[model samples]
Target: MPPMLPPLARGDIEEAADACAAAPLLNCLLREVGEPTGDPGVHRLHAGGRLLRVRGERRPARPEVYADGGWHRLTHPELVKLAAEELRRHTGLSNSELPTEIIDSRDAVAALLAARARATPPAGPYLRSEQSLITGHPHHPAPKARGGGPVTGWLPYAPEAYARFPLELLGVREDTVVEEGDTTALDTFGEAPPGYRLLPAHPWQLDLVGARPEIRDAFADGRLIRLGRTAGPLWPTAAIRTLYAPEDDLFVKFSLDVRITNDIRRLWRHDLLKLRRTDAATASAFGAVPGSAAWLSDRGYRTADFAFEELAVLVRDGLREHVVPGATPLLAAALVEESFDGSPLNGLTDPSAWWTAYLRQVVPPVLDAFARHGVVIEAHLQNALVAIDADGMPVQALFRDAEGVKLLPQVTRAAGWERLVYCLIVNHLMELAALLAERHPGMDPWPAVRRELTRYDTDHGLPEIADLLTSPTVPGKTNLLLRWTGADGADARYVPLPNPLARH
Candidate 1:
């Protein structure tokens, strides 16, 4: 068992929850629909020209609107209303669901806070970093909304709540099992009876879809049977559906029926069919790179022929084999989203050297893969992990999630470059750079980033790099507008952000 956290009062939890929830909503409203005024921390709504004031830089808070001849503070609910109204007017689209999700996200944070106050964080640094995101996706409007379901239903499995539970196991008859490549690691979880294959399921997923007619009929006809659960518990990673089994050094990703940040967390068949090809290309790219950077491949998947989507489980390579010896792997998202007790960012003694090490480890591989292999990796914060040695300087960067990766001929080079900029630069590097500069006030993080990218461009001969450095703007994903307009999760829509590289 892990060590327990000290309890906090109800009032403190509510206040913390409000602050956590408001930051993302305000960020979205400001970036997507609100226009900045000359005054610091103040913006004018693009639709109505109403002036709004905020407090902080990274995580903006304490919102106030100038109305009725004075500034009136807005609560979390009021802020949500203001965002909805502004988006409705700005886009000329009315969305009743997004407003509810914003409220649901706030409520979910409150529940997570209360549970975390009484829960135990894992002892290992990797798992600790994986489960440390209390303020997830700093720019997303409803990053924590858990399908608007009851707290009791999701709190037990939430990564933010430090959840660890044994996977529910089942046996699929040989003829009914559908598998791809290298799924042998899953067999080690438990022994299957005579002619059945071992298939593990996320308990929450089964609870959501088990009663479907097809699944119920499979169990009734003896095509599937219960085989009990693993003897040990698996730690849920930042991506809540993916869990880590330390004993086996394996990651098991299940098909969850809930909607996380942008998409419903199901392993769709279209993506599953191309999984092997995608993983192979990514593996080849990383293999050719002459560095410690690695790719944690999604080796294979297993499912029942009858319940292909709902019962699917993917086997991913674990950290033990890829990470450098005597080093610890930490989630990139945790470094910027929230700092824990063992966080390397919190323990930084030489911020400039540490920032340079981080840039070297993280930047090259993504660019190399795009330029050399024609493979575009989704190297966003959650998909990347940075390993650090005893003194807390970065040593390696390992990236995962082949399902989100795009191949060259499948998408145009311009489109792939846009995505790379959004994921690698806007989402991953910008947040970390801002956090480092915020910590060390005198440090200018952009020059190091500019130098690193310039070296890569000089050797790789990618023309986009020159334009990127001099361009007035860089692409930023418009999550709030995407959800409001009900766009497909894969159909990325972007807005422009002032390019820090251009200024540096």
Candidate 2:
């Protein structure tokens, strides 16, 4: 394999997005490990760590091992040193054994593994990352009956990053496997099922997926289009569906669902459509410069289509893996569908607090993306992705799931343009303001959030976020409301986040 690879840079596209979500660790890893399986557009590396994979023989590679909250603690100091050495060794392996270039996944592995390890609890597998709870085999946490054809299961939980790599490393042939009852285990990096499910990326969706073809192309790419589990009548195909035209990903929700109230549904729906609309208008469009679907709207490309299951899949895959930290709502979800790992913020003393501050600070630049393009967006937590660096500092804010972006028709009409202020500022930003007020008191949270957004319009005439990466750092990192907690004990409702523009 190659000894060195060039640095990974969001340098152009994401650089202009927002500095808040930028991960230099991603950049560092790319320079170190070159790349790993799948995801060629980017690079990867063999970051060393005590990774623990636990899947049955049938679904061995499924991240249900790690993301199902199945993680093993890497508490031993010796294990940490070994991880680094192993990564260096892996990067030096022969190219025929494992190519050193691709989407730059190896670089992310260690950082991500470490972050997940930090999230692990001290006592049991709860915080340590365990896979024991995900399998459906008789010995699995949830045993299946012999009469089952296929268990009727939908992961109403946090999804893990696709558990496909370990299998590829083991040289498993995915085409021949993927049966309902077949199982295998792998023990290369620690523990794993030598066999598993083979749901690889569809070739046509490459533009959006960004996973490497060299590794995942075997599952179904060139084959016939395979449908997932059969759909029942109750599944709302009309609105729940999503559309993807090449680099585009769009979704919508009809007026339904018993558990969701009109307020929640309305908020959810508005954020959904508004986000897509906003991204299509701005640089949030997927797979392009200065865009992430939310940015695409600014360029004048409308949605190509829609499907409920498709949207569900998007949400599922998205939550499973993070393109940028804090961007996916799956960050807030306690339930997991698929599994994934690699969070830069995992080592923090107070991870929840860091996440809270992350959510609060992210709204600004996301709303700013709209302002840069003379557009308005529904800048809410659901609409934004929060990114924290290795040190747990909030560094980047990228928006996706376009359905949440909206251009205030009223504001646009008044100025002979779409009212970005209404959608971005009033509709979306205001709601988050309420949340910050209720969920994270103190520190002029509303103004602090607004300051970042307003700066885009006032300073650079609303520049896209990429340019902000190299730009100056804003103030406010200390929260004045440290003494205040929204609710106490296990019912604590508020988050402890530092003020983004704080002098502290």
Candidate 3:
């Protein structure tokens, strides 16, 4: 039997959940629509003309809005209502869905908090790190919203709750099997019938799509056959759709129809079709880099033609091969959240040295990939893994998720560079810097970042490096505004934040 979680009071759960949910919402409101009010931890919301203030940095909480000439503490629902009203006025557009999502996200956090209180985190450092994000996507309003489905539908599969389960195996008929690249790792999971090819599916995904007529019809016609679940359990990662199977030393990404953060976490056919090119380009670029930094290649994918997006399973390279020997690999995002058991950032006496070492491992590979191969890796926290040695210092950086990568000429250099800046600087480094600075007060992290960038000789080529170092504003993605305006998640629109890297 699983160990019992500590009993949590109903009121405590609600308050904790509200805080978790409100932080990201408040972050979005402040970033996209508010300006600093010259008071510490206070900003003026432009549309509502209301003064909003919150206590704490990184994860802002204890929200209060100025109204009726006095400060009023806003509940989770009130905060959502305020955000919706401000966004509607700011964008001059109405979105009923976003407001609903905001509420759902808060409720979802409540449920997760309750569940986690009773559950035990995974034993392994990597698995524990992967499941550590309770307050996901620091800037998105609905980071934990699981398609607004009931708690029963998604709670069992949530990483934050430390859930683990076996994958359902399926046999696709030889004629219906569609695959590309090195998907051979999948066959080892379970045996298929004589004439069929093995296709592993996430049970949650199967539960979501199994009832469809097309899927039912395929099963009836012997185009698809159930092969039972894998004996070994696969641990869900921070990205809910992806699972890490320790036994096989493999990572499998599935097409989850649920909207996670921004996009429906599905393996789109268009992305799958171009998976080989992108993965190969990334692999080659990392290979050319002169260091231990590695790329966890998306080896390939397998799916049935009829249920393409619904049934897609992507095979990503496991960490054992790419990670340096004697070093442990932990998700970079987990480090930002300090979610894992032995985070390097925790209890650091000299953060300056540690921050410098981190920049060395992470920054060079990204710059080299851009300069040499024109491959812009989405080096956001979730996509990055920093492996550390016995002393908990970074030795290697490994990146994954080829689907998020953009090749230079495919998107113009200008566009690709912008995306790179958002992912690398704003998403990855900035978050890490904030966490480091918060943990160790008086450590100015940006000068080390500036020094690292200065070492890169972009003088002959990319001028963006110089511009970035001296620029007043850095790109910050507007998640709340984008969702409110009903824009496609991939169609990223950035607003400018004061750049800390700029040398004054």
Computed on alpha carbons, the lDDT of every model, listed in order, comes to: 0.91, 0.28, 0.89
- The lDDT leader among the candidates is 1
lDDT of 2 by residue, 1-504 (tens): 110111224223221111111122122223233333343232233444323332221121211112244544322222223323444465443222111111112222222223333443222211112221111111111111111111111111111111111101122233433121111111111222334322322212222222334324532443222223211111111111221211112221222111110111221323443433454465432333242222213211111122111111222112223344443322211111022133333233553455446544554444444444444444432344444444645555545444433354534533312233333433343433433343333424444444454554466564433332233332111110110111111121122122222321
Candidate 3 per-residue lDDT, tens place, 1-504, comes to 110111255447777777778888988999999999899999999987889999877778889988788989999899898898898889899889998998898888888887887999988788888998888889999999999888999999999999999999999999988999999999999999899999999988998999999999999999999999898899999999999999899999999999988899899999999999999999999999988999999999999999999999999999898888999999999887644566887777788888888999999999889988999999999999999888888899999999999998999999999999999999999999888777777778999998888888543355688899888999999999889988998999999999999844
Candidate 3: stretches off by over 4 Å: 1-11, 458-461
Q: List the residue pairs that clash in candidate 3.
A: 5-118
- Which regions in candidate 2 have their CA more than 4 angstroms from the true location? 1-259, 263-279, 284-364, 407-447, 450-454, 461-504
TM-score of 1: 0.97
Model 3 weakest 10-residue run by lDDT: 1-10
Better of 1 and 3 by lDDT: 1
- In model 1, which residue pairs have backbone atoms overlapping below 3 Å? none
For 139-184, candidate 1 gives per-residue lDDT tens digits of 8999999999888899999999999999999999999899999999
* Candidate 1 Cα misplacement greater than 4 A, ranges: 1-11
Would you give me the overall lDDT of model 3? 0.89
TM-score of each: 0.97, 0.30, 0.97
